[model samples]
Target: MSEEALEYYKAAEISELQDGKVHSREVDGELICLIKLDQEIVAFTDNCTHISGPLNQGEFDGCSITCPWHGARFDVRTGKVLRGPARQDLYTYTVKVEGETILVGLPPA
Candidate 1:
């Protein structure tokens, strides 16, 4: 992760994130999704692997997220392709939380 990437999510609070919900946020001009599952934090690109759907509007069930535009499903934790229509996996980011702040790191672009 680059220094600029680290600075982007330096102030995210885990408490602000609701469980079983997907939150959309922009960092360094990139759309990212912050998902909370059973108190665990996960980050992934907001774009779907198929047709570039808005993943923020997608439905989530436990560890999987179904794309809103298409019927593709993806694992929020590993960004794995769980269902068809999207064979490729979404981009994932490293997440960490400290006290009231949540941090996510993306690879240097």
Candidate 2:
């Protein structure tokens, strides 16, 4: 494993997130969102790019999530901005699964 992979923090259990659902968790004081898309779990910063709205409160449509505050939308898999009042993309995190545990990679401090 690489150094980046070594920094993963346990965010959730694989069974905790159902297919086509968005789940939020706070890890080390950082709010993160986990979405199960196409049987894969993707993680992203829970804050919306527009005005720091809670992304976990947004609407998820299997492939994209829309910010509830300002109508910004992002691709769940790549964090790409799909529709925008927000120009920036969400900060995506790397996810790993070991047995039933789901780990999210955190950036170095």
Candidate 3:
């Protein structure tokens, strides 16, 4: 699908996130992890690619998040695989801030 076809859904309030922290939210039935990295907001699928570990529960070390279950590491910004047991990268979502709200873009249904 084209980038314009994705729908942006409100995921959280900008004020709710603090620098270098990760928060979990459910948007359109999808589990998403919202991170505030260097004042920018980033979103990723909450499940780890290897074994479905809850990424929201993982550890954020400023640049990457380490999956609690298997220690898979993924970059918070681009969701690139930084370290593995996971051969796949985490799914990333586009983020936009409108006033105090944070919106996450998802593929259209």
lDDT of each: 0.85, 0.88, 0.91
TM-score of every model versus the real structure: 0.87, 0.92, 0.95
Q: Quote model 1's TM-score.
A: 0.87
Regions more than 4 Å wrong, model 3: none
Give the per-residue lDDT digits (tens) of candidate 1, residues 1-109.
Answer: 4445554455267777899899998877789999888878898999998999999998988899999997899989999999989999999888778887877786665
The RMSD of every model to the true structure, in order and in angstroms, is: 2.6, 2.0, 1.0
- Alpha-carbon shift of residue 67 in model 1 (angstroms): 0.7
Q: Using TM-score as the measure, which candidate wins?
A: 3
> Tens-digit lDDT track for model 3 on 1-109?
5678889999998888888888999999999999887768889999999999999889999789999999999998888999999999999998889999899999987
| Model 2, span 1-109: residue lDDT tens | 4545447789988878888888999977789999887668899999999999989999998689999998999997889999989999998888888999998888766
- The TM-score, computed over Cα atoms with residue i paired to residue i, of candidate 2 is 0.92
RMSD of 1: 2.6
Whole-model lDDT for model 2 versus the true structure?
A: 0.88
Q: Residue 43 lDDT in model 2? A: 91
Worst 10 residues of 2 by lDDT: 1-10
